[model samples]
Target: MNARPGSFGRFVADADAAGNLVVQPRMGFCAPHHMRTGLALTKAAAATTAGTLTIDSYTRVGDLAAARTALGEGAPLNGYPIAAHPAACTRALLDGVVDDTFPVQVRHGSSHPEPIIRALSAAGLDATEGGPVSYCLPYGRTPLDVSVDNWSRGCELLASLMPDGRIAHVESFGGCMLGQMCPPALLVALSLLEGLYFTQHGIRSVSLSYAQQTDTAQDEEAVRALRRLAAEFLPPDVDWHVVLYTYMGVYPASEAGARELLSASARLAVRAEAQRLIVKTAAEAHRIPTIEENVRALQTAARAASTARPAAIAPGGSKGTGDEYTQARTLIEATLELSPDTGRALRAAFARGHLDVPYCLHPDNAGRSRSFIDSTGRLRWSATGAMPVPPAPTSAGRTSVSARELLDAVHYVARRYDAAPAD
Candidate 1:
């Protein structure tokens, strides 16, 4: 159980430098043995991959008592209850599996993630991903300020693990906000901005995430924008890379369509020059995906990525990003002007309309922004609200969206993908 790659940060960086697409699964189970089984399967898969331990609903919401009870009763919770389980138990679960090369990140959807981080870090895990704003605004009614404070403390704790000379990588969940229909500009801005926030809090080895959007070209533009912005905004000493998530919107229901979409996502990751890709299974549109389904998806992604000629990923600024860069920069610059501290700036930015998420109905969210898939199959802002970004020149412009329009926009990707034959 020696730290082979030694640190998740270094391990992923190695993969990036080697041009290997580091694929990871969102797999988790209520039982510790099941979680271990998933991780083992992922590590043995014939793909460059990482492992994930997603938390159950109770643990995510701070109901460790319920999680503990479920575990005791042998009831099947939705995901692993890492917080309620003892640290030794978690370490055992990861035994012989999680090394430098096979790093596992704890995925918990908690706005106040201090306790969870404490548990995961104590369990000898060095990587986890989430953001104060990204974790809060989308999931619940948690106050923005409270989440910021809690995350600052959590970052400090996770950073403390580096005293043993291993880097604890923290990835930003900001780019994957609301899963779908959020404009890539906002997603890119939030991802980079959150990475900056992590840097300020002393976690230097970080990753910024961008989920696949409606259009392939647009998604490529967004990832390039994120990389360009990272070079410009992130601290020089910090080690960072881009992670792409498969489209988090309403997935294609048909198995053929789902595989096509997943394959496209894998190709997109390579073409965008992302170091890591969070994959989606063919079972995504239905119930929870089994471990076999996850393994198949991982292998499929590896095959797609192996054949890909990754696009050139230099920091080309405007040439790399276009309008996505301009709008995202507007949002980031506006927020930074509010305060030097990343957390405080985020709070102030959202309080005003300086930063907004489209189609996000969270109370703290300004609710003014809305986006829709346009005529060219690109996700475009229908209304920018009070955001600093200019109005999009697309057909889905400043008009209001009715309930029917919103429903159609939500299903836009599913229809688009299903209409075409699987490659």
Candidate 2:
């Protein structure tokens, strides 16, 4: 597909017109310093000549406005863009503060589609019917059975709501599993299957969001594995992207450290020919990142990508780490196989039309859970515990919650309370 006219182009042109080197993609404008850096990077990387590269920037809602300002004022494009947040928390983002946001939407057996739909409306973004902005549907740490059913139902609901095709992308989150590793084959197959499912359901883009250890050679190998999967499974017609979000709390605490990690990540991405790169801010694992901190982090990552030397693609190793590559391949393969079973369960749950009320470990469950369910139906409270069950079926028949609603419920539960024993 032809590239869409992105905010970056306008930023570049604006910078050039204004005689500034800096160009911010968010506002489609540029300044002089930005231009010089771009030129310098272009010239410096001429030897490696990987061809034209594109980078999109992403951040959280609290940082969106500032990120937009930095981008418009001229933040570098060596990284990919993707703002991450729990599905229910991004109402502010869709309110139009950031360019985009990816909210996790976990599916239990039930559906709660209103928040997403309402958020889209509140943001003045259209639905699939009205050219809605791209939103992420994240399957959080829900059990495989619930996750698949939730995702499938979510897709069906989205398709139904967006006959005109509003969704632009769909992504999944990786959680700690079996040593926090998914088998390689499973990863590959799931990637393709997800792409197919989204494509079939009318979503035009698909991506995966997972955290990685920046300190290990294994991380680099995992990137290579992803590249191979992209090459083999990604349909030529599909707009596919992969995001290797760093676990900021793990390594690279200082500016210099962050730069080194970013440089390494950029090289890996370039070698892999990844469509986009998402460089996590240093504050990620520790706490929520402030806007200024995030911008600084992106700046550091951009510099690394722009200035780093392209490492030779080792015969089989990435950065001389053979084990990394081997492990990555193995893990991805294993994960891909499990995806179908996961998908099947998710589809079945959606078919059953049960609501997955979210319960979390956090203290904010009251506001969060209420936001997910509709105004008319009350949350069915279990006599034994705090777990809120779905209200009884209404006169219109058992009131069915959308997939989005189920996810919201899951998010609420996960954030505020531990999962209750499954009924």
Candidate 3:
């Protein structure tokens, strides 16, 4: 989308096509408890502040019936209206679960928009000129493999689908940890490259979806680093939105507790001047969140934003941001200059299990038992067949899994090849 300068309020106003404002709610980071409770809070906030609330319903990860239940139960309590996407709304439409259905504009895969647009038109929900509908794309971090060839194909696909420019806003899918691995320089380059493409096209609004981490000491540092990187990469010229989620991966015990944690995190984000804040519920660690959880989390985030104030600028201001950008640039330059060395080092690290690259969520190691040691020295896995799925902890705690364990697993699997008498 074309990047433009606008306030959150302005963006909301511009996004509406039904002559009414709608707030799109999503929660994919926190535990389910937080999401359920948060939806209740969001409805209350919208009622008190905005004209009226129309929920953009879709589960980031959950069951639909339970979500509908939470919405039905909570909407009345908060005195606001709710809406569901086509998928969930389809069932609700048939069973009379909701008042109306809002279809989500989706690109089938990687920027190809034609099929989706055609489908929307065929379904008679084409609000291209000024529809109340909004588009959602399941965009993860630009995959490591997003080469020029892929980019060209993606651009061509989008161009074909959106010839008339009917889409109002685009919401990217799935939370990612960009700052954890991508250096600031790389972020700037990538942003510049992608930003140019998006701006060249007619796309107007975009939101960054980031997986949330707890505000522990280590996490706080990570957040600070990430914030600095964002400052460097996020152009002030374009309208920007940020979605922060709580770590449901670790804390999935209670929804209420998760909400509390998310609220605290939202407060932190507000201080940082994040345009939009989303709090994920705690239930996501084990299962997909029901619609109720999604609504609850959105509700809680809305409430939190209502009372939040901007925080004072940190000591470094944009200095840290600039430095990270410079460092990233240097790294990229070095990599280009020493591709052979860099590749060898990267492969070596991968082989040793010292570095866990993105997309390689699982890896195997040989000859050594595996265990993850937490900050408190607790080991979670050993001799991996399938790692134990620990119960979601109530408090933020750490557990370490050793690289050796992965190596052992790799070795065990490789033995079959080794024993196969020379092929």
State the C-alpha lDDT per candidate: 0.87, 0.35, 0.35
Candidate that beats the other on lDDT, 1 or 3, i.e. the better one:
1
Query: Candidate 1: lDDT of 318?
Result: 41
Residues 1-423 of candidate 1 have per-residue lDDT tens digits of: 111246776777788778789999998898888899999999999999999999989988888899999889988899989988999999999999988679899998898787788899889888899989999999998888888998898898888865577777889999999999898999999999899999888886899999998899999998888888988888777888889998898999988888888889999988888889999998888889999999999999999898887676467534455888888998999999999998999999999988988777788889898777777888877777788776667543356667898899889888877888756
- Residues 1-423, candidate 3: write the lDDT tens digits: 233323232443343222222334442222223323443444444322111122223221213354456665654212111122243332232222111232222222232233333433333322211010001112233222222233334333443454353333333322332222211222233232233233234434444434444223323333344444445554454443443434423443445555666666665554544444434554544465555655556566656655766545567564224343443344333332433333232233224433222212323222222333333422223222211122223244423333674344333312322343331
Ranking by lDDT: 1, 2, 3
Local lDDT at 414 for model 3: 25
**Please, what are the lDDT tens digits per residue for candidate 2 over residues 88-161?**
33333233222322112211111233334333333333221111001122212333343344445555555455
Which candidate would rank higher by TM-score, 1 or 3? 1
TM-score, every prediction: 0.96, 0.46, 0.47
